[model samples]
Target: MASYWRTPKPGRKIPFIKKSPVENPIMEPSIPTHFRCPISLDLMKDPVTVSTGITYDRHSIETWFEVGNQTCPVTNNVLKSEELIPNHSLRRMIQDWCVANRSLGIERIPTPRIPVTPIQVSELLSEIASASRRGDRARCRELVAKIKALGRESERNWRCIVSGGAGRVLSASFSELAAGSFDNSTSGVLEEILSALAACFPLDEEAHWHIGSPESLNSLVLILNCGDLAGRLNAVLMLKELVSSLDADRINVVADTDGLIEALVKLIEKPISPQTTKASLVTTFYLASSSEMTAVKFVEMGLVSLLLEILVDSDKSMCEKALAVLDGVLESKKGRETASDHSLAVPVLVKKMFRVSDMATGFAVSALWKLCKNYEQERGEGCLVEALQVGAFQKLLLLLQVGCTGTTKEKASELLKLLNGMRGRGECIETVDFKALKRPF
Candidate 1:
């Protein structure tokens, strides 16, 4: 019998067989048809059935309504109602699917949260109104707590509250309470009102009208002065929003409020948190930007030193805002005098030129330019020498070389020419090493 397998002869040519390559088929996980949303074509987390008997994710349907889509996405039929009914069975099935596919990296969806309804919001507002009318502080507090709770629950609830007129009602309540004679005993009510208002952020223009009143503005300033940290933060933020939206006349009215500037200054001087500090700075910027008088008030309130302190310690954003406020303040002669008097004034401005953002660099350069231009003619060589001593020349050169905004570059060039001409003319008594000023990379 011939051997089934034969060994090849040593050093002899052997016949070889070539086999085709085999590929393993890839298997993709199959997703249940019902688990997919018709609109988004993704697995649904919170499924809801619309009036057209088509199911979609809650957020998708709500977004559809927001975009003014009145018909079903699948059928194109006009929806009789926009009411969304939770598809609990579908949601449970999807959750079960996720659990079963845990080994495939599918995460189990958490229990769906119930959003606040318009009817619930309306009832809370009615109860709050009743309590407020009856002068029932305790009851009012309870009801206000409920409103706040709903607002804080989720962004969806916040929209529901705002849509249901809770923002308007809260603003009107604030105005009403502020207009009346409110003593220390009523501070709790004020705190609640402010907290509610802050939670309802971006108050409507109608609410802004209520918050912009003299009574409301002054009451907020009072809260800044005497309220707790939480209340003060809300009060300052509310004031910032109101001030930012007010007209020139209203901003002037706010500027004229006794102790308003002082209150903001106090917040900056003794900051409870970085948030409070930033809000105070923004409010001051808004006020100062309103008019020359408002700018003067900031300088008169001794905001320069506090601002310098904040600039030294704050991050880039805060530094930018603080510099902006300082720029506004420096528009006034008295403002320049105040800033120039601080020990870190010139040095701080010079250091911040290339260190912070381009916007900050613009503000810092503008501030220094303002100081030098304003006092250069009157104070003569002293101001130029001061700038030179603080490395202003080097910073400006670095600023130009590094490149900044067009306006900023133009300003820097102008300032650099002015300083160089003064130094060439021997107007600057102090000697500055131009080469040494160039920063080493």
Candidate 2:
């Protein structure tokens, strides 16, 4: 250590010590440089050495890799591997330092469990795969249980299992099990696989395809129908991710699955939780948007009525999602007929306008436009009249004045024209000066 002093000053030049540079003369404990994570600057609880020989907290380094950085944070060298080796010796020293500084309010870092390794994850996956081949359901379930536990340990372990191809392995097992018609004995194992599989999301492209395959779709259907709440929740969320990536042919295959639409509607009709309801709504929206046949099926299932019911009572997030699903449903003529027929649909949707968020208002206005456009050809037909009677006309006027996207503004303007049509011949739109008010848009 070098001896140094504060620059000679008017009064005193205090000598510097090896410690306490970062602390004040008022006597706070100084933290050592190596004890902190470079990224977070907090004490490193579970330090590991990266491929570049730089040590970091395990979580800190995993986050670094997760964000698409392959280079060392310190030296800027490209990392050859993502392996994280536990620095047990340094961790012990950190614990000891904390214990010695306990009087200064430092807490000891707990000893960390060994993180799952790629080879270990691969071996378990292999064992599970082999057991499935041998038709040893017990062994396969036990192995999946192990993977599920490891996945629960840390995001680092989940990354290990994901990169090692657990998604394909688990989906294949679930597909085969599901093919047996979903007996009582298989429920536990199926749930285990889904729990583990969902944790690996943001999966590799190959894994995504595996999960979205026709066989896996059957498994998802069975889970949605008879499996428990957690299982159904996982199924719908998985379907939401899967549907977006599927081509038109594959989505048509999805829409064609017998009893699939029924199960989804049941989930929405009898929502297990807000999360489950939201996931099913989003999944249904994607399917309905992708296929006209699917949209017709949902309309037949009274999805519009259910969504309007939700809009009348649900929370903000629920209302927004329900409105979005409603808008998608109205894309079909049958959906518009059902919505316009329902006693509360027009009023519920009109109630949402200018009240929730801009998105909700947009969806509400879009939906009204669809119904209005449907009945616009029939002058005395009541869709536009019904909307205006619920104060939708005033809300649309306010929405346009508040400012919106070009598309929404256009929709609002068109909706205004439609609602104004129900006015009497003497009570025309010209009575209210259209361009007199300043429109921010």
Candidate 3:
């Protein structure tokens, strides 16, 4: 769970300052002149211990064998214990050398590359919108051809449409591009088509928002119904983003809600291929996670079992995404009560806590804790005590101790405090105390 995406740390490299005279005793010159290694009268480098775990470098002990200064000068006896002599001197010299030699001047980590320029993208998007308005399929295809020539993989995710989900794709040679052609009539139609494809296939915002009419949604649905699995998955992804700006109430009112939901549910139930199945599930998750509360509606319409099936799947990615969505749903106003009514939901999620591969168990635990909190608030303190009796508090405590890190520390601490208070040992709101939690587990 460590993020590799670190922001650049900006600062000048400040060199280590030498300690003041007060920091150390006055140096003795005769000791080093009398006892210096014959090879070189300088401090040791790469000091290490021998078989007896007694430390000595080539200049210290080996020099004793060579130049016959075996008996210690300062101790005035045989060098019995290297430990008796200070080790910090050697360590300090090595560190000082490294700082002087190996340091870089004002380290500059390379900035991450942005995929496309905003002005270029915005212009391309507006062209697509114009082509769609002008009904120039051939011109749109020509525009896409030039854009595609720009690069494929780099622009794969970057190509954005304004409202491709709402039907903008059709106006910009969407159907033609989906067929692997970009034959449109207008001079800049290729750019328009590319923008439309960006919006619809990649569902770029510029492309999606520029969607010409409702026909685009229908066109995408048709493409999903007819094309191969990738096409279908892409179509659903487009629909997910398009629906974000779209009023669900309007879509439900204007289009066939039962039809669209049924198609999505059917795809969720039986996808054409496993890859398609997973891709569709992700689209479903995006839809569920989308702000429209479509997932909640799907649950209210009795799609919980369908979603749970995905959540329990062996696929790790799907499980994580699905669990995140389920977590979100269970935290939502309506989803909270609905999840509580379902007896098996909590138990299944609790079991996931045991799996090492499920890195999302922390999120699951938090969601469940919140659900229980909501349940407690609605029911009574007695309900919380009942949940604690059922081992909720112990599980949460274990989760906090093991799983909590970075930002989650405060949350886990707060939850533990509350749960401890509810165990009836002390107070939480009025005062914070957890002396009872210190006992050996």
Candidate 4:
């Protein structure tokens, strides 16, 4: 069926644009040399003139500043002020060029947006606070939408909103929703509030506490259980930030909260995007490291088997996170026993070392040392034989040769001693002994 879009004026004729079933081919047009950003060397989408009078792509120059570079990328001149003025004239010319080449599939650039000042964001937050005190949910949500729009505009706007205390204010608005205000009509507001909070990261310490509140966390758990994929992803992301900000005691409080553990485990059991999966993994690590009870709770929830599954089939990024979470889980007795009982636990942990990353290898070694060392004491030489069967000794040896962190090297050495003793393979703890072991056994 053909489709048509109407103009905003009801009396205007409808234009037939027949939505193409497939994407239009994007072609590279010869952009004018002056249209290119000095830093990025690409046709600028959002050109902004910096303090040094050099025009660059907004995102590219912002990145340069973000990495602690205060001088102009082109001139090497020290920036006197960090202000970014939109190069509206250049941007308009770029857009005109794009439109002129529209037949070649070039899309017009969007108008550049100016980031709100900290003062403006602060005033908006004050309005939300007043709405909250007045119990005005409708007005509160409207103000939150405006903030959300600002965040979606650009990274600079988001930084302004976050530094201006959007995380604190939005979380407060969410707390109000958590107090029995959730319903079909308010789910939009719920997701908007949570999504906005997810963007306000690297939050101040005071903002962290407000977002990690008991009521706020419980509400997130509810979203994790039944919310749509987008909402659930946002919930897990917000939880990751919340957990990252918490200490052991605060983490313990989150762990003891009803339904939170199960909800987080479900996030992993059913994979969303890699992002949500990673966030859930991080959130669980904080929970497991809080106390033995929480770790046991994760083990009881079948988290051990799930993490092992992740280790077996996931990519390097996921494997690294799964290993870290697994290492944290092994701090508890049940966590260790559960892992030891799983057939893939030892072999998979050995397989990950020297392949993923230094951090991953560190977690893998720690988890293996705990599992095998504990089993050596409790289940006799059986675990040692299993480690040898999976070539744990060779992998650990190679790990040390390739270099690892201090703690990983220490754990790898101890595991090597145990495995070498099992195989009648002789080697001391030092690096030279590992090199000498290549001559038969």
Candidate 5:
């Protein structure tokens, strides 16, 4: 019979070594409940061998390492642990366990098996990472199965590898999965991939506030290229939070901005659909506000021309949002400079002032007001009178007669005041009765 204490290896402390055998062996004593996993507090799975020759619950071992507590729980000897690839299901299981325990008012759960050896976990993660590097989806899936078999023990290390450094192997794998080449049969796998990436890629407020690594830009570009808008929106929100500067040389800030502009323009080019239009407009707003290079690129991409089209489009909301953005530009020094050229954009505004829709006319008059004021200090009053000559006063009268009844009146008064300055200076044309313009019809 194998003696219960048959004297094991020098460093190895196999708990089952001295236990019962097949025939007539003494019944193995029941381990106290306290010997169970501290995390799950259940029977430990695949207990890992630690450096000090002791064993512990795999999940508990991971938790200790996460918060810098890598010493063997029983032996109190330093134990090296491995870097983890994020496993979403295991993490959620652990999270669920924690939640359940907390509600039951448990304070601390005691671990039984020493966490799996760090070397073991690292070996598993390396295999998955290697598969990702080789673009071997099959091998990666196999490795995931092995890690998950460890149950909650794999959670922490899995998170680490998935979202760890600027260049994480697990993140790369998830990116590949998001590319849609993966079989739809494995969307459950895809969900895991996304969760792992999210966990690994949490925003680092300090790191972000200073400057971002090129890797951050790379991740964002991947997210943007994907067809999933929810994922894209999440990535955008992350960028907003980080406020990271893009590597202009490698990333081509201008081209990316142009692409975003092109997408927005395509969304609004035809008769705009309510859902897609709203989404596109929101996307445009995000792009406009994202970086300085964004607005500059929009101008370079001739977006001003398209914006002019939307300004005249039948949709009031679209025109209103587009003009509101233009208004922002006008308020800026750069926008002021851009509008001062006035060769093309100004004529569009001139044409829009006569538009039949009250909303369109309002936007047109408001934009003109900003443009007129922008050059008011530079071009002087003659430029303003010339603008009025191009049918500014006539449109103002039309707005006053029909469009100016409600909200138009306030803007009419403002335009009258703006035009009133040009009255005595520019070859003044007192077309509409000033008293008629002033009266609330």
Candidate 6:
């Protein structure tokens, strides 16, 4: 064994083995139980005491109220109100603990910013009203900026501003600006006002009525036509909200506003952002879907081509919206004529049948069914031939085989039958590969 295990030579120097010093592991400090929220069991960042005398994070409590919960999380008792009082003492204690545990990688929380009160908002509005009355454009601009800043600070501040009658004040100011002579110096002030109005929390029913009034509605239309990009975007957002809350009569009023449809169409033609484009589309859909005459007006404003363009580039959700608008537009004779006039219209609709969601597929099928049912004969068999050439017949048959909405299946079956009946004596129909109508997937 000694011979097998060879040893170092007698003249060889011994190797030095210097051992490293043992490292002491840093220990994390334990968090105090009292500093944690009862609900989240995490350290409270913005602790606020609720009516139930329980301390929770402000965001958590607010969310609890937002989701229609009216009881305390800890007690499960009915909350008298959603009021939250800032727990300054507890916050200070938590800050002190953070400072003491700084070596443990704890961050010091900054002082929480106080939300603007309704009284402050009311006073600001009064100043704006007075400035507007005195024609003090500079002063009105300053006040509007302050209000906008406060509104941007927090959602709570936005609610405070709206509750303080900011909507009514802004709408009246817009009306004054619209009715008066155009002043280049005051246009910026008007834009600021529009921004503030758009930033307001969802308007209540009363505020909607105020905005949908003749004066306010007309002024908004003017803004949409002439304001800068920011102003126009805000105007569209406001109009969307207003249209949603308006009754049928108010919708008619909006539909009748001069240049409103034209302005929305222009926005679609030159979109600033996807959000603005969607807002315009939704607003248009709401207005058009209100009445048949409204739909006709939208179609007359050349909405079909813009919608088709949107369909070409839009994602799944936007395609669904575009198809929905198309369905509404096709409810009128003018709409059908415009759509059929576009060379890519039929082909695009056919492509979207199975390319997007089931909802989009249903809308596309409905549009095609309506077109074929109404104008297949009018186009003298050429329309049917064009659809077949574009593989519309193949897609329709595939749609029937795959899982789709019931309405889609029915419409597809009907269109297929109609196409088959019309394919008599046509060469293209004979060459068509019926067996190849399998799902693309």
- RMSD of each candidate relative to the true structure: 15.4, 9.6, 20.7, 11.9, 16.1, 16.5
Alpha carbon lDDT of residue 230, candidate 1?
A: 96
lDDT, candidates in the order shown: 0.80, 0.79, 0.50, 0.80, 0.51, 0.78
Off by over 4 Å in 1: 1-31, 40-43, 76-78, 92-113, 183-185, 376-378, 401-410, 425-441
lDDT of 4 by residue, 1-441 (tens): 122222244343322212322332354566676787666566789888977788988887766666566677778887776778898888888998999999887888888667788788999999988887676777877998899888787777887788677877877777766665567545666777887877777667776776677767777788888788999999888878877878898888878888999998988998878899999999998889889899999999999999999888888889988999999999988888888888999788878886688888889889989887866456666667777877788888888887876887888899987787787633323444466566673
lDDT of 3 by residue, 1-441 (tens): 211122223452222212322222243222222122323443344354333434444434533433333344334455443332334555555545445544432122222222334455556656654664566566555555544554353432233222223234343345333333322232234333433354445444445544423544555555555545555665566565555555545444323433455566667677676655555555555556544466567677666666566566556766665666677566566776666666556655655554635356765665566566665556345434444545556666776666667534555566566667777742332123454455576
Error of 4 at 219 (Å): 0.6
Task: TM-score for candidate 6, please give it.
Answer: 0.78
Q: lDDT tens digits, residues 309-331, model 2?
A: 88888788998888888899888
- For residue 4, model 3's alpha carbon misses the true position, in angstroms, by 32
- TM-score of every candidate: 0.82, 0.83, 0.47, 0.75, 0.38, 0.78
Count of residue pairs whose backbone atoms collide, per candidate: 0, 0, 33, 0, 16, 0
Model 2 scores a C-alpha lDDT of 0.79
Backbone clash total for model 6 is 0
At residue 163, candidate 2 shows an lDDT of 75
Summing lDDT over every window of 10 consecutive residues in candidate 4, give the lowest-scoring window: 15-24
For candidate 1, write residues 248-275 as lDDT tens digits.
8888888888888989988988889999
Kindly report which residue pairs in candidate 1 clash with one another.
Answer: none
Estimate, for each residue in 312-420, the C-alpha lDDT of model 6 and write its tens digit. Answer: 8788988988898998888877787788788878889988987688899999999988777765445556556667767777788788778666788888888888788
lDDT of 4: 0.80
- Give the Cα-based TM-score of candidate 3 against the true structure: 0.47
Rate residue 312 of model 2 by lDDT. Answer: 82
